[model samples]
Target: MSTSGRSRAAGPDETPAIGRPRDANRDVAILDATLLLLTEVGYDQLSMESIAARAGVAKTTIYRRYRDKVALVAAAVEYRSQSSPPAVGPGGLRGNLLTLVQWLAEQIAEQEIGLLGALFAGMRSDPGLAAEMRRILRRDEAAMTDQPLREAVKRGERLAPHAAELFAEVAPAVIVHRIVVAGETCDERFVEHLVDDILLPLLRGHPNKPARTERGTGSKGTRS
Candidate 1:
């Protein structure tokens, strides 16, 4: 709700003007309404009229800012991301990763399953919406991984060459799979296991065993 000092993704025609400044309150109202509707209904069912009604603003007011539904939804997604950024806690890589994954798990768990399903459906059906969401998600994922990895470097930790990319892939995939796909609880124990057992070994490039070479073909392989 508090958008002070936060930079939002620009609306379609949201250029600066010399006229009376746009009301920040109205922007907040509109964005909040959009997210609420997204959770309640979905991208396919959501409309400018519904958002306008929920926000208590004219339909024209919504269109005047955003070019279309995709643009509006994209802006809303960006706003939500900017509003609730990842909370990087104090400590080294392990501590920070645990904190980050726990936060991510909590956020994912808070979302309604229906909303998640709707988003998945929408993304599959709508190219424009999928593209917009992907762009926003990639940026967020980078932000989530960059800080902890940078700090780990400062601590003289020997990380794998692609540590950030690896973390970005492994942690979220496991968490989302546990909650959304497997319908399992992503509790504290699970988070700690993910960080200690899987992620830490991976980032530090600690292989479980040395590669074994086949005698005939001379092909090397490691156990999964």
Candidate 2:
């Protein structure tokens, strides 16, 4: 009964022989409701019945489209993030890094820290959810960092051989550390300082610097 792998736009309309056509609007409603509930109730407290009530749909509709709560939550997160991705970084490594860092700060500030805490807990508790979240975040991180770093190296910039991994993680890692651990605000000033002080140095450092032993240690730096 799971429609998990079906295309987002491919509803029951595609299969006339099936029961009543699936409403794309209802799909949006469900996702929107799920996201709202996630923010308001936290992942552990969120339930399909609650989402159904918020969305004005039956629990069966939710189950028909998603395999479980984890799938539903993952879909909702993806739905929202894909709709409003951080703007693509501009030219130059500095500019690109600043852009990414600033955007992350803005998003974290806008959503507030509590929601992020809930996300962190949810990801830690559920393997399936964690994997899906990591996959999307890694894709976005690569999109932001890879081309810019490559271009910087081509532009006569002296970058470490592992700059791609190390430098790319700077902004997101520091931002999260500050917000979650240090209890600091992630603002424009914070982002600028991060880009200027930490990221640039790492990128421009010698390749001989000690590297992190674990491959996944810093992957998906941000919790997107």
Per TM-score, the best of the predicted structures is: 1
Q: Candidate 2: list runs displaced more than 4 Å.
A: 1-21, 83-91, 177-189, 206-224
Candidate 1 C-alpha lDDT tens digits along 1-119: 11112447457558664679787788889988888898888788999999999999999978878988888887876676543545556657777876888877777676667666766
lDDT of 2 by residue, 81-121 (tens): 53233343545666676676676665554554665667778
Q: What's the lDDT of the predicted structure labeled candidate 1? A: 0.73
Off by over 4 Å in 1: 1-13, 81-90, 181-184, 207-224
RMSD (Å) of each candidate, 1 decimal = 8.3, 8.6
With a 3 Å backbone cut-off (N, CA, C), the pairs that clash in candidate 2 are none
TM-score of each model, paired residue for residue: 0.77, 0.72
